[model samples]
Target: MNTNTNTNAIAAARQAHSTRCRQRVLTALEQAAHSGDEITVSAIARRARVDRSFLYRHRDLHAAVLVKAAEPATASTGGPSASRPSLIADLANAHDRITRLSHENTQLRQRLSEHLGEQAWRESGLCPPDDIDRLQRRVTELEQHTAEQRRQLAERDDELDATRATNRELMTRLNRPHPDGA
Candidate 1:
């Protein structure tokens, strides 16, 4: 009976219309999925006459809707078979994609294993390979350093021996040659 209540009802109807517009956009997306053809979001927004960002922000919901929509329709013949070639084609395509991605995943895992092996080598600081090499470069360097130190030690021992021998010769000469002076 009041014009004020009529205005509020009109506003409520407009809001409901906007909500339905957004829902219709989602419906269009669900219908287009599994064809392997690109579904342009802009086209959806244009068809719904709604803002595109709202659809983008709720993309997970959109994806869920598409998945639900793509579910196999009930087989009137009580089994899934040659009766539904279109559905079968879509399922076959999905199967192929799953297999291909699985193969790629294995290859990636192998490469990651190789990368980890290289990292372990770098971290351990072990002599780089060639345990049976002709010249064993790292071991050769260690052996050369050891030989140099041994040579120096032998020379020092020789000098000590020569000092002892001279001391003994001087003592013999002193004891024997003093008879002439007496």
Candidate 2:
């Protein structure tokens, strides 16, 4: 029996690929419950491309995605109307637009810590202010322009040491032997 007909043709090709992955995860949970959408086991394993651990090992597609994620959202012109906005007035207008954008981000971070002064607001550790009087008047105008460039480089090194002591006394009076011994 050719190995019992090749083990019943590899168990009928793994039961026709587990009946085409359980009919594409029950037609992607009936097209995410006819489009109100959010059903979930990772949105029916990304609309049945499959494996969220095969929709958590299929306990009836994980109890039909927890009974279509506890059902309640009907409205497509089917009933509830008094001019729409209910889910607790859309969660109290999203908590009053997140408390008016968290008090306009604390008044634009207290006007950028009073326009970034105090040594650029303590080197940006945010807010602390003794106001570095304009960085101590730009470090007292760069220490009086570095003490007037060190008094003009000590008067050009005392005029290059008096022109190198008058060129070493005119090369010691032309090498001394000009005493009429021309």
Best lDDT among the predictions, by candidate number: 2
Residue clash pairs of candidate 1: none
Model 2 ranges off by over 4 Å: 1-96, 103-135, 169-171, 179-182
**TM-score of predicted model 1?**
0.27
How far is each candidate from the true structure, as Cα RMSD in Å? Answer: 12.9, 13.0
TM-score of each: 0.27, 0.30
lDDT of 1 by residue, 14-108 (tens): 87986787678767665544332334566556656677776676776456544544554443456653323466688999999999999999999
